[model samples]
Target: MTERKEINVLNENVARIEQEQPIGISVLGPGAADWEFWLTSAGFKLANQEDADVILWVDPEAKDFPAIAKDPRCIVVGNSKTNALCQQKKITYVKDVNDGEGIQRQLEEFGRKTRETLENPTLAKSRSLTVPPALSPQRPEKKHGIRLQRGLIKRHLPPDAPLEDPKGELREEFREESGPLSRRKDIIAALPSLGEDERRLKQYIQEKSEGEYRVLEVAESYADLIRAAEKGFFEVILVHRELPGLERNLVENLKLLREKAPGTRIILIERQSDDFSAMYKGHLDVIDLEWQVIPELPGHLVSLLKGQYERQPENHVVFKWEDERKPVTSLPSVRTSVLSPALIAYHSAGGGVGKSTGATQMGFVFAEMGYKTLIIELDTEKPSLLRAVGAAEDCPGLAAWNHSDFISERTAIEAIRRTSRQVHGLYVLPVGPISPKKVVLPFHLEGLNGGEEENVDPCQQAAVFYSAALKEFQIVIVDTNNSCVDPPVFMALKMAKRVFYVMEATKVFLDSAEAHIEQAYDLGIQLSNYRIILNKCTANDLLSLRTITQTLEIPVSLQVPLDVEGYRLAAHQGKPYKPKTKKGISPWGEFCQNVLQDLEVPITTSQAKKPSLRNWLLGWKKKS
Candidate 1:
């Protein structure tokens, strides 16, 4: 019989066996113990061969073959060589003796055969299933176009088949033989809600484009359509107007798809009654053809989008939504209008001026006001931000960012989002487990810089980091090293919307402040953006506030008095310095509030506080 007829008979026999419950089975010969365990688990009860419905004769090629083959209930299972006796006797054979599935199928067949024999006893005595001559012990057995070795199947490749797939020629041959659209990269994704129309549209597009573009059937929802466009890199997307998300707002989702995949064209499919051309401003033509005329639509669309692709296989960038990162010969100037995240940089001309403390305190204040805030510690030499924030040092921060392949914006966002730990609504990312001498922020090393060491600039990487950080957070406060030559400080000063010049009221700090400001101005930081904070102020200081302002040429923003013991106490406790007092707010909080005012951020808290216990306990509550 042909393989197809055998498969059909096997399926019919299995279906017949499913109607009955577990049939009694008996085991004999070698491997009987293991077979008994498997048979019992398969819901077959053990019994003697005389009383059992079926006999599983394992290793029937042995001397016990004749004894088991005489029984009509026996199913011979093994790589048996019983001459021509078993075939002449008409016995059921299982070639792979150890295969559980094959054994189960043979058992089910026996069950059906026994049922049929009981229903018509004359049919069993008159005829028996004849084993094909090809399955005889003298002839080699073949199964499903593959040569059967002892009990296993082995495929033999053509003699001229290539051993290696160099240049992907072999893979291309396989793809070409598999289907017309198998190797096509330019996809045209269609939503599943198109129903029967989806098949017709796919056929039309394939007929018109001549298999240059493949139709990818995606999920029925608009959200999944966006994901398909993002990963599929399609040439065009067919979005149904009746999609679930479009009911909320059609224009918003179209704009989102445009942003997510600027390279792909979105063609909205709707009926003539549902017109959104005026709303979309004919940004792209909407497909409103009748059902009969849909075949002609693909021909015209194929011509218009023949070679125009927003993204290409060889011309892809790290950030598809943004332009490619070009090589820089000079320092990048800061953006004045669209400074994302309202970045504030805390810098000082020298150490021990409470720069980190000021940055932490300000971040805490912004976080308290319910703005998602992150404090990026750019001081790679001595990263004290983690210690001050009380988070563990063993974190994937700058070290992970440096070692990881942040080839796209999503990777950078996910790295920062997954690695950073939150503290009282404030997120703190450490420098790393082990502080490096310099942190390299190579976003896409090979693609952006062509794998050249000279192109791996720390300043450029800082810009990439900041660009991702802007999307993740609303308020970003950077704490930098004292040196102007440091990549973190220079980039922070240049990119920050507001820069706080933290220095003590001492003469040593005051004198160096002017030189640092001049160097920063030469580096593209405007002098107007500087907000000087006089830290560690003393009552008997020699330099007055007016003289200090004259020397620095920028007016002092705030004066924080000497608090060595208080700061030490806060540091020991591993928290920001927010003094608990009966008064409304502390001086540190007031300085943060002033900084917010400079940034033009509203000073409103997240939610109103509950009434105090004193108001309910006594009669001190205000009457409404």
Candidate 2:
């Protein structure tokens, strides 16, 4: 049994190697599928008769042959009669395959002979004449070969040139003297590894600048490069195309660099023969280099420096073999609106966690403090803002606007209704009953029938409404549904500038919050964009907060004291909570005040007022 297993393993390896061959083989005649399968399993790619590198005719009495079978590459595989017929036609013939081992040997010998014949001087010359020299004879060790060439270039440098400063202290001192705020150029070279290429480039820059340019930092790894860029330590970043971690994470690293150092110029150093169209799609300049021009690198550095000083519009510098200048097309400029509103979303892991309550109350506070605030109820499955703010359930609101024939800024503004006079500049756009019923279907399921002419994606419609709201309101607070998986809620979270993930102080709630956070991350939500808000907290909840912070590695930005009675009484009256003490201070009021402070909302002494005894007594009675 063991010997049989060994033979099976050997056959599998042979099949794999055969299938990986570049030139595929085709088998004709009876049992072709089985033969093809066996050939592929032994490691040979199968191709059509016309396109195959070799064709095997297996049928003994077959008269017709594919046009390609007439070529010397074709062979006949069968009994002795087939071999005799093949000799009459000057075609190669092999004994019929009776076992896997015999067939394997025949295929191996055929591949070796085919390769040798293809590599003949006459065949190679013809192939070379047709293909471009640049595309000819690609070697796996070319990258290392280029490195070696660079080393040779360094060895032949003029003896008069000063050795590069090992510590680069001169560059550091220059940077300190000029300062980051200075207009002088501070360059950083990020290479795959510290070698002759880096040393040669650094020397060239220093010699060409004659004290003008400073190599601020040299990074050898992706992490170091990103760290330096994030710190904004340099004005120009020179990236070596062969940098470690670049091939796998090129797009990610480039995006991060663009974001971290928007003002800094990025120059990608690449081989002159490389196709860099993909790299050009990003915000980077390409500097094409050749081995022959390694000695003249200083001249190129000086030209780049001159261009920088002159404020040239072109970002790329291409050096061709003929030393011809190539025109570079500039990337399009990004446009941004000046009046961008602050969009904040309040979300929770589960129901009854005071997410909507906090969002509405916060919006009210912002409005009362004189900022135009709009509180949007995005929970389509269960619309609650209408009930929370005591508005009529049938009121035309977000749903009506979404399903309207034409929605605009005017339509959005008209959809919102002013909250009670308690909060002056606040407006509420409730998720009306009709829209909720229409949009409550699972995201994966389709065919949502709203009372409109056409079906629209709930998330897309919400985005349009949100955009219009942004144009009318200074601050938009979105109250998302409990489930983070909801399409509308997920979209809101993505659009929000700041997301407040509200959670109750309990084991079950914490567990839900943890799961929600994981889901949010999977949806590409950045941890930096979200802050955990511990709501309904007691003295004992402090320990749990610490544990949560340590476990999730997220900061708890706000903790609201457990004010169940205050909240219940306020809810029963269908009104936002008011200060219960004489000094215009209560647990609920204090929490709101702290929230305002944390959000950086400006507060004036005039905004505060003395508490009303009637309201205070009513709340106290309700609590008792």
Candidate 3:
């Protein structure tokens, strides 16, 4: 089957008239002087009525004007008689002319109309001819005619006759017959300076291709490069590493260029020995001057145009470095209190993955170590923290705060209820009486007012509350909903200094965890600030740690062993479980200690004490 070609004539005309060339406009009568000045300043060409695509009529009473005014392409400017005539004729009219803003508005309207006319021209009102047989205006008629004749000859050739590869032979013939001036490729070189190397490359390409490759030099300024690229005038863009104003913002500038000219090939010129060369090797072609000199550059450029280069590799890479040296020093050490509180948010891939449980347990650990910790139940959907801590279910908390207009520091502190006496120094903020079903409603539904309420984002209320809680507490732990796409969950992740992404060790949970982490990365969260915690892990599954780490590209900081019986007993009692230990630490206690150590929190002297043997023996007996 022969290859098919699709052409969009209207789009082609619009692009040519609006972008490549100035739009032609005609103005009539005495009051059109201002209109003519504005049109010329806005990139419109002043032309006579015979050649103009848009004609503006400003005169109230001009002879033989009815026929011209009836044309769909005519615009009637403000004039008493003209307005009445246009109204009667049911034609478009503008009523204001003296106001500067009005003139600008009319200019914009005219531009829009010009584009629309070019994009969807009516056969009866069209001022230009339809698209020609050849798609490109610059394509020679002789060349198109020759190609047509060649196609006809091939169709008539006998099926049994031996046939050469016509496409390959025709391409070779075109290359040999056409000189550099006839088939030159347009290239834009964005370099810092027009130095010897740049001039050499340009001269080499022109000489080697016999003038088939033309390089247009552009200043290294990003604004100039971007404007040129947006015009879509060049087939290739050559960017140097030292381009002016791009030293610190190269990646962002290149991203803009890529978006503007997606079809153009971008090549980065850098020294082969440069360390940064490897960083940009995969995103775009890297031309190393050490390996490929000026003479070979032209052929390489052609190869890229012909799609002969290797496919681009993954563009993102993480580099890791390790040092084995240990330092020896003898000096008095001073311990300084942390200046800012640590904000930790617990998020899971799905519900029922123990996000709240982990957050509450961690809060208790911090409190036991002498840190004034606050656990905010941000999961309005379920609001399980109150139930978990055995606090009053109807206590005023996040919901009440959301409904109130202003909250004083004293009042905000009072909203937090102390946990059971067993866990001292720990506070709990319940989600209040709001039903989980209606938690998704907009904050405006509550009708709360005053104190930055006008600037508050409904999705970011959790962040606002977290900020207020930080004023009186040293550590803030937020238990968020499972869905990463949830607004509250997203805000929690964005504001937290550290995040604990909790999940089970099963295949289903692992898949969900991978997707969740990927989505977080897409939202611009740094991977270093997040730690993956594999909950309910077993000893037998330790071998899968490597696979999980490789798949998610994040290290698992802690793995809590499965303890169904302990969790069940705690849930039944409506409180977090605290294991009793004697000679050695219990599995649950060991997990909590490891997490605290990873967070760099110093354990208190009270927590270092070992339990009595009598208690250990009693615990063993109960287990038996």
Candidate 4:
């Protein structure tokens, strides 16, 4: 039977199954990009979905889908969940038949089988599916026509294999072909006395690029690859499984690339099957480019490219400013204007300073200003913002997880709720009570937690997890914890285009915040950041701000007085709290507006060097 006919029969069988049973279609993970891929490719229609008896569940991760199997009518699949289980010795599966003689072999075979299935109604409905090659790209092979044939492998694989045999022919083929057997044996029995003649594979390494095989080196670090990107190298970046000093800024590098190299294509390569794809799905055009171990060369170049890089092969075009080739290093040095710096940080200092309220309102301002925004409650322990906004929906975070029903672990982006606010583009993902014990980060790296100091370094850990996903949205606001000392808090802090130090109108608050600000600066944060917003200020705070600004020699960004009624109403409604009245700009709003103005690139004359408020105040005094 041909491959085409086989796939067709599968679709027909599925249709018949859905008609015969109470077929249900359930989504296991958040935003599986390829549901449409499977829906269209597999030839399933939604209108028919309601009537078709069987359930087709497209999950992002397969691990969360075990219970769905219990239904007997539903089949769940996602690369993440499926691959992880395969590694842990769960399911038995293979690819969609090998097309050794080009796609011609597979296509022809599919057509034949599909016709046979339709003609003979006796075939079992649950026919086995050959797994698609691994999600990672298959490496290229040398000089296409020739392939290594292990006779032992032939012994294990039957004419048309059915189910896997434990001690059967397949095991011997694996051992003899590339497993323990091959590694222990020498290349050939006949060779010169000298070792060079015997170590032929090593010789091929020197003349590597000349062979039909190709090299796929995953870049070592994000920074190294980003630096290479700044210089415009668009090849695959080699990344190491582990490294030091990589704990750096998140959005800054991506921001720089967007500014310098917009729409750059990045391919992620990992040493483990549990790679960083789903977590950073929206951020990259292709997440799992391919997978391989350290210091080991891949076997087939053709498989690697087809599996990975082929998905997104585009040459990027970056916007460049007109620069006359003149050395003006000594000319009055001026800074280039950049996009508005959005601040996404915990509002209150240590224990107080209105952290939740500050973040809550800032989220409102960002959305109102015509920017699509998403605010995640990284403040895992307190879980105030969700309740404050009535988004709590009366369920603990655990309530959202139908562990058995979910096929893949969904990201916060998947579980967010859209709010009914004037801010048309705002969305919220709230934090629930942290699992009493552990925090599971994206990419399955264990031991990172919040609500207190995190065990994993935030910036480094996030680079491995979050930063890649920032590409998906226009802007993402993270309402984090109060402890500036926490390394991972920098994970959110470093991603910020600007960081606001929210302090109360007291000498003590200012003093405490200065220390945190200093720590950020020392730990690779730029100093242009570090703006101060005095939250919940009173008349006394006005006096203190004045005295402190003069003593500290730093400008105060804004002064927001306490508004108990305005905040409490929205908090009770579980809606984002924003001032109803356009009522002359609160000091915080004005500061935010200024940031928006400054971020406008190629600063217009009117915007740069506008008369300072201090000067306007002086002029008013003179008039008086």
User: How high is the CA lDDT of each candidate model?
Assistant: 0.57, 0.53, 0.53, 0.39
Off by over 4 Å in 2: 1-340, 380-382, 402-425, 433-458, 579-584, 587-624
Q: How close to the true structure is residue 304 of candidate 3, measured as C-alpha lDDT?
A: 46
lDDT digits (tens) for residues 168-214 of candidate 3: 22221212112211134556666554333454555555554444444
In candidate 1, which residue ranges exceed 4 Å CA deviation? 1-340, 403-408, 434-450, 580-585, 608-624
For residue 545, give model 1's deviation from the true position in Å: 0.9
User: Cα lDDT for residue 296, model 1?
Assistant: 22
Residue 61's C-alpha lDDT in candidate 3? 51
lDDT of 2 at 261: 50
Error of 4 at 325 (Å): 44
Q: Pick the candidate with the highest TM-score.
A: 1
**Per-residue alpha-carbon lDDT of candidate 1 for residues 375-424, written as tens digits (9 for 90 to 100):** 88877656777667655445556656652434445566657755565543
* TM-score of predicted structure 1: 0.43
- Model 4 lDDT, full chain set: 0.39
Query: Higher-TM-score candidate among 1 and 3?
Result: 1
TM-scores of the candidates are: 0.43, 0.39, 0.39, 0.36
Candidate 4, 460-497: lDDT as tens digits: 54443234224323446667677654544666677676
Best by lDDT: 1
